[model samples]
Target: MANMSMTKTPIAEQDPKVRARNFKEVTLGYTAEQAVEEAKRCLNCKHRPCMSGCPVSVRIPEFIAQVAEGNFEEAYKIIKDTNALPAVCGRVCPQENQCEGKCVRGIKGEPVGIGRLERFCADYMADKPMNIEKPEPNGHKVAVVGAGPSSLTAAGDLAKLGYDVTVYEAFHTAGGVLMYGIPEFRLPKSIVQHEIDNLTAMGVKIMTNMVIGKVLSIDELIEMGNEAIFIGSGAGLPRFMGIEGEGLVGVYSANEYLTRINLMKAYLEDYDTPIMKSENVAVVGGGNVAMDAARSAMRLGAKKVYVVYRRSMDELPARKEEVHHAQEEGIEFLVLNNPVRIIGDENGRVCAMECVKMELGEPDASGRRRPVEIKGSEFTLEIDTAIMSIGTSPNPLIRSTTPGLSANDHGCLIVDENESTTKEGVYAGGDAVTGAATVILAMGAGKRAAAAIDKYIKSK
Candidate 1:
């Protein structure tokens, strides 16, 4: 029987007050009964528009049908057929803009909790060992740069295809942004490790602390018997506003701040990583990264955290859930405000930030209203620390070192429709190809590159 309820089954979550203080997961996954009810809400549309919205094109309707029938294992298998990182994607992917957006139920009511159902299915099978038959080696070697969502997906796909796949990561840890950028309060490290373990189980070898452009070059990897290479290095280089006081003592980029707190485990008393303990913190940006930074600052004992954006609240680039969570945690939103410069104190530490009020103008290239600054509307925000979460670009190391690997002005690698780079037998994807983007999009690029690499290698 189709569930015609106007609202989908609600998943339980930690209280805002309680979750705001800890680094634990916010949303508790759906129970078996709840999963079934949610799955029942899926009309199982014949067109399967949800799959079209997905990057890797997971078999959505089939999985939902399996879930509805209480066949959790079968549902997992169906999703894993295309998606390599279901657990990660379920937690972090913006389903509202993708799968759930195209959901038929969303036309009249809330979408069938697709993300929540995916999370439920993943968590249900987390303890059970997957019964996977490792494919026979095809004798071709493929090197993947960066052990991020893209690289991991590419490696997993290639490994399953019987290619000798090895992923090289610059960080000491293997899970790239998953380990360093996202906070545990949203995406747990254990879940990420579990997914990586699944990939390794499929014969994907991961080498950490192996900086590709430095430790080994693309030419060197090719010479060392790597028949093909896929670069998913990701965009790690932080962008600044080129304003004053950026070099001050208490000012940090969102990348560095999140990296220290998440990757270095600074929040844990056991970890020796040093982080700034501030009374007032301002995160400059309105994107998801900005939300992560602001929320993280609150958990880190900041008395007050402000998300300072140049646009209105409606134009915030962050997920609505994230913004709501931040608000519930008492993080202030200083919308329609743009920072002009950071103010430093006598000792060269951030003490305040100078900002200008902004008003919306005509639509810009991004289709969002352009923020025009108001003259004589400059104001100052008193703060001890400032975290810039403006954006990030791909690092120039790989492009500078690897000849013929072309990149755009933003340092994003140029790739063809098939994800093949100008350098033959070499390919790039993920944030390395498209500037900073969603995890699912990066995974999609990896999946495509893996298929292309497989075809390229087999043709030789």
Candidate 2:
């Protein structure tokens, strides 16, 4: 640890009870002083195993050195060289499992705060003028489907290469799941919009309200002057546990429920859109999305919010910080319980949900212990609302229209190491390729696909 300065740990965030009542960002960003101090904790190892966990491979040590020296511009340059969306990554990336996971300092003490430093540098440069390089025009046009993280990264990279990229987003706004799927408390809409604006500044054309497979097919993209097409349309289909009373009123897929509130701004007092209400709400799942939905429901004025999961607290898959915040906001946790049926009232409105106690069985193929219900341990609890956050797969629209676009049994599009689809000049990646995954993994897919598209266009 020679020549390395120790950094102070970040202080605890604001009380969740007070913060959850509003739409403000949950984790306040690090101050300039705090960021620089945290930067010093890096040992600047020669091998730099931390970079190995990074998807896009930002120069971890170099950036830390710059921040340690108080050279903010140099630090940002090191990050922006590869990562196109640092601001978003800083806030949402799972550093604990990724970059920080491989840190040498983590052998004994805490690891260097690479995620926080990346976020700080990105935000610092965001206020100043953008200085990203614009590659010489390649004179080829590419059609990018979806505006989620994958497509955003691909489009940004393709735009820099001067490919005349146009992102087609089905939603009114440019961000796909980022705009609708994620709640404002986790990722602020303004920050996402600002990042999109940066891409536009780089000459990336974005077309909103344009559903690709429906409005135009894969064939149309090539026919309409686009030499190559990149499908990054993320998993839009929500999975529901097919049980009784699923059709009951007030039951919602987490996607539909969050979109109704986040993208549509249904919670705004003067907003035109409206959302259903209930005194007690139940969100089924143990992931971060479940936490987001339950917390959001509480903000919408629900008297009580409950997280229903089949696993124990230790096995819950949500981020530790998110779990801590949810508890602070007064959200209740119903662990080791599985929903059997969603019961409804005489009017077909959701009134209660039947649950069964579960015991952890042997590990399943997915590696997590499977939940086996204890027979005769069923119980019913009255509830006004139920939200399902199991998971989602890519929509069938693209696969339906684009012949020869190979997909597996799960309906997720199949792509190779380079992200080229079965089609000659088409490439697909992100959640569309792998099922729902982290933002960084999807971003890596996008970066890889951009090169594939560029090479295909050159060959043509």
TM-score of each: 0.99, 0.96
lDDT of 1: 0.92
**Alpha carbon lDDT of each predicted model:** 0.92, 0.88
**Candidate 1 to truth, TM:** 0.99
RMSD of each: 0.9, 1.7
Candidate 2 residue-wise lDDT, 302-407, digit = tens: 8889999998998988877788889989999999999999998899999999999999999999898989999999998789999998888889889999988989
lDDT for each residue of candidate 1 in 1-460, tens digit (9 for 90 to 100)? 8888989798798998988889999989899999998899998899999988898898898999999999999999898888888888888899999999999889988988898898888999999977877889988899999999999989998998899999999999988889999999999999999988888887888899898889999999999999999999999999999998899999999999999999999999999999998999999999999999999999999999999999999999888889988999999999999999999989999999999999999999999999999999999999999999999999999999999999988889999999999999998999999999989999999989999999999899
For residue 186, what is the lDDT in candidate 2? 83
Q: Which candidate achieves the best lDDT against the true structure?
A: 1
